[model samples]
Target: MEENAIRNKYQELGVEGFYTQYGADYSNPHEAQIRQLLLQNQDRIDYNKVLDFCCGSGEVSRTLIEAGYGHVFASDPFTYEAYQKNCGRECWQYTFEDVIRTPIPEQFSAVICSFAMHLCPDEQLFPLVYQLFQSTSQLVIITPHKRPELEQLEGVQLAFEDFCLTAKGKQVRLKAYTSTFTY
Candidate 1:
């Protein structure tokens, strides 16, 4: 992905403005189907202090809240006012660099990132994943499972055990592995 294009798009429209101008109505049937799928698995995942990284419009954040998760944090570098207004919450404006530089406030029970990690350039891969592991007690990364382009990326294939066996030995467990595809 071209970082400049992404940044420029956000700059031109901001998060909410862009979505309003270009986004499809989630009220459509296909989105309803996706929401049903999400709800089906919502019960299986841990949600304590969940962080929705790169949460563009906080759709999944609202889902987590509706599924009964409390203390959820949503973030993106761009201003997602549409999402914030929809969810009745504010978003933290921070880039992945900022996320890595600052200490994560809580050992999150679940960290959710969808279509977010792939945006990090190749050089930022390891460091970003390391920080991701550090921030979350459980990681639920949702990316295109069949993206051959990303097949060799370590972040996509990283085992939960690898992060669990740290010097701190925080006694982490590989709770689950999940993925999806976009049509």
Candidate 2:
């Protein structure tokens, strides 16, 4: 889809609605930048166990796996088929709301939410993040927008950040955070 068309669709249906309807076909246009950012900072992630939250099409999982991070799990309420097909692994069907209601059962070294965290509504962000922190010490959010700014949350701290630019000069950022609350 064209950029403007995607934007219009998002405006028309809202983020969750749009994704619920089209997530199986969703593809990140900034995938190259996402790959670049992850490959450049792969060392920062713990390969022990990582959850690719909101793993649309398994972009982050695929990148991390290729980088030799063996224990990569993925979850996306809407993109299970795409994620499984792309990454060749089972994708947990957990939505952000689900996580907020019940934290993930397994602990992870880190949870990577790529391209989709910013879409979370403001009211739900804190609880969702708090729940995520319950499952992992590290939370890595990769976004093209600055809305999430997870560091603003009381217990969350931005430990490191880096960015990669697209051909049109848009900045895609990788923000790694840690919270005072331990799992």
Clashing pairs in 1: none
List residue ranges in candidate 1 displaced over 4 A: 1-34, 145-183
Give the distance in Å from residue 146's predicted Cα in candidate 1 to where it truly belongs.
3.8
Question: Which one is best on TM-score?
Answer: 2
lDDT of 1 at 75: 76
lDDT of 2 by residue, 1-183 (tens): 766888899999987788789988988888899899988886786757999999999888888898888899999988899888888899999988899899999999999999888888899999999999999889999998887999999899999999999999989999999999755
Give RMSD to native, each candidate: 11.4, 1.3
Find the 10 residues in a row with the least total lDDT in model 2. Answer: 39-48
Which residues of candidate 2, in runs, are more than 4 Å off?
none
Q: Quote each prediction's TM-score.
A: 0.62, 0.95
64-168: candidate 1 lDDT, tens digit per residue:
778777688987665356557677787877677876786466677677766456567667765665666676645665543222133254544433321122233
